[model samples]
Target chain A: MATDLMSNGNRPSAEDIAARRKVIEVDRLDFAFGARQVLFDISLDVREGEIMVVMGGSGSGKTTLLRHLVGLMPPQPGKVKLLDKDMGALNRRQLLDLKRRIGVAFQFGALFSSLTVAENVKLPLRELTDLEERTMDIMANMKLEVCNLSGFGHLMPADLSGGMMKRASIARAIVMDPKLVFLDEPSSGLDPAVSSALDDLILKLRDAMDISVVVVSHDIESAFKIADRITILDKGRILISDRVDAVRNSPNERVQNLLHRRSEQIDVDPTEYLRRLAGD
Target chain B: MANPAKFFEQIGRRTASGLDEMGYATVLFFEAIYWTLTGWRQRQPVRIAATFAAMVEIGVAALPIATLLAATIGLMLAIQSLYSLGIFGAEQYAFIGIALSVVREFSPMIMGILIAGRSGSAIAARLATMNINQEIDALQVMGINPNRFLVAPVLIALVVMMPCLAMWANIVSILAAGLYVSAELNQSFGAYLNDTLDVLKVDDVWHGLGKAGLFGIIIALVGVVNGSMVKGGAEGVGRVTTRSVVLSVTLIVVADMIFAYLTTR
Candidate 1:
């Protein structure tokens, strides 16, 4: 039963399991931005159905890795492949096709400012498919409700708060019902309760749609709660890649430091801050 | 304790890195190009409307003004020519001066100056503000090219309207010049018009229109380049806009001089 639950050790493999395709594979990737060497020989894969979390601190090149996956910032020629295409060599039309297959939720939930929520969600449909008005409206509403935003279709992004903005962006992202989704810092700015609700949404979305997900975030509790597998990156390298339970039980000092919250503390004394400003 | 020679080498490295910033600007230019191209198509109404607004602001709004302003500048050139040639008792030769200067130089230069103030700075300001608000980054993540979507259309629109503006200016000014000589200098308007047409050959008009086109290209390039290169926050966008306007206008003037020098004898 433990083995059954282990389920291929929470790693993505190109093997057939219920006839679903593997979504992402990064093979011994060595990436750099002009000698900074952001990713060092990183190797990983994400299956067609699971929430795989890339956990790291702010500047740990996780975003760089995500950009590579989306082909926003290209990696060196031969290291990464998405949806079984040689992503490095795919021409514009092919790149567009693959990109359409995937959905991305950015850190700030980068919704188009000029577009209303419904229009933003309709963008992918307009670009890729020929769905009619009723169908488009129905599909858009369903995704909106999934993100807990049912009828706020006419609201612009500027009208949304941080939490709603992420929800709306997620709605826009998955409007196409993409086979794979990439989310960056979904829980970063929200309160804990709202953040957990977002986590639940991510898990439900993944399960219901059978969509593969690669989420980049540093929120430990959120990562553990939602992630089937977590790959921890440190100093441009994957420090540990394992199932959630394995990671929790492991005695690695860095892991322990993070889990226990014993790393460093900046105690805020209102008196001290006031005194410092006032020059006691 | 590296060698004394290595100290200069270190300074050279610093200089090289500083110069890498320009290369980064070039990269931003191409990045804007790439970003503007990759986006999935959007809903027709909003796309069409935003495009319409951009065209109206960059092309239509500026067209009549550019024409009228350049025409008036040409009229002033005619006035100055009549004044200068009137002294020499060769008021008919005023066409030689006004037509050549207005068609070959002033029309394009004034048009460029007008666009720099009107559309070029506006493009820079828009891109800068968009940068502050993360629209460009949003476009990138969504696989859209901000440059191709935003700047390219404006560039095309400017290129389209600039020639129209210059032609309008040419006609208005020639008419103004003929009227000026007829009323003020006691010369027949038809004789002045025929002389003007006779002296202003086809090559001269081509040369002037060609200069106007170059001016349009330079303004678009500088404005887009500066807009894409803008970094920092909201205040930074404003700074980039200001700098872009100044640079575009100055470059237009300098380019006009180069055009004049090149096309002259």
Candidate 2:
């Protein structure tokens, strides 16, 4: 298993290390929405064929960071390099071409409501490839099977359960066989068994297709289970980024607190609280 | 003094925002046109399919309403003109007046307004929903040009279909008016047809069709622009869709006035 080989430091073996290269490089990424700063000088690297789980609490800027990585939001006061090309520097055409190699599965599936599941899965192929209709259909079904939704492609997005929707979205995301896949909260809003099965599917995808996977999730158990490396974000800053074992054994107070599900409490002054309540 | 200053400030802000929206719409219009022409040259399947679907929605599906409105308006116009013209002993001239009005003005203007309300609002709502659902972002992430995929097809369909709808409306309206003149007004059907044919020039037909085409372009632009600019979520989509209908109707009227003035001169 891939995890067995990386159990030491979660680093690829020397023989495998030579074959892997950085696919995504984020340097000094600082983002702000109007007056509120969201991401603060964050940096990270994703290797060619690894599952990197980005975990954060609500409002921790995990989704914002994912958006920046996928070029949905531009890098301001920072740099992001994808496939060795600077995202900030790419023209519209170049950026579009780059997007063809990257697949993003949004949290809510984001499938076209007017199109059936088979149509939704075949959309990328229809738009980007010259494949025959039969070939596209076959390919879409193959992907649906991989996501454990083989026969469900005939249904519409509204007809599917939450877990089914997520799986269908994953199927659509992988239909094009993209070099990089970004799954946003794939296991979110799902039962433990379904989520675990999804985690296994993610692992199988990375191992079989040799594609890099960047998953933004708050599901700690799933993150710990599937990630070769885990990056924890808190309050718009990265708390820790290390191998799964290293993260598990880390001595950092905040990291330990997070792993143990401990919440922090802040003492409030009575006068200040009263003043705020009085609309001062 | 402060109140007056605030009023002027508000006016200035509104003007600036309106101009900004117009500028954005203009850019979108040109981009949609560019993509459509390029895609046609390249024989892009997605653009072709979208164009066909839009044509069915904007043209074929809208025919019944367009015809109904035209026929009712034509009957009303003939009745009103006959009542007034009868006082002057010029009731025989009602055919000429109705023909000229329906062919050069009412059919195209009413058709444009109806389509702006029906198809334009629908386009805005559909695109706005897609915007709120993150489907627009999904399209962008998949290397698909949203404008080429969404707007260009509708624009092409509207431009092609609006004039045809107007022409159909003109024909139905004239026929309905002729029926009233012959049956209710006690005028001979042959004489009424002759009077209408004598006054209705080819130029009148072209002018109405031209105005309809321009109004179609306006409706498409306003719908797409408002939809693409939608922020927030479901509430935003609702707001923009309503605004698109109101703005499209206003723009169509404005364009009609401009065309009327220029063509007359």
TM per candidate: 0.80, 0.91
Which residue pairs in model 2 clash with each other? none
- Interface DockQ of each model: 0.28, 0.67
Clashing pairs in 1: B35-B144, B35-B145, B35-B146, B36-B145, B36-B146, B36-B148, B37-B145, B38-B143, B39-B144
The residue-by-residue lDDT of candidate 1 on B149-227, one tens digit each, is: 5665666566656666677677877787778767877888888888889888898888878877776666676777677
For residue A43, model 1's alpha carbon misses the true position, in angstroms, by 1.7
lDDT tens digits by residue: candidate 2, B53-160: 899999899988998999999999989989989999888888888998898889888988999899999989999989888899899888888888888889989999
The models' CA-based lDDT, in order, is 0.76, 0.88
Off by over 4 Å in 1: A1-21, A128-142, A264-280, B1-53, B131-134, B145-147, B172-183, B186-199, B258-264
Q: What is the lDDT of residue B249 in candidate 2?
A: 89
Alpha carbon lDDT of residue B3, candidate 2?
98
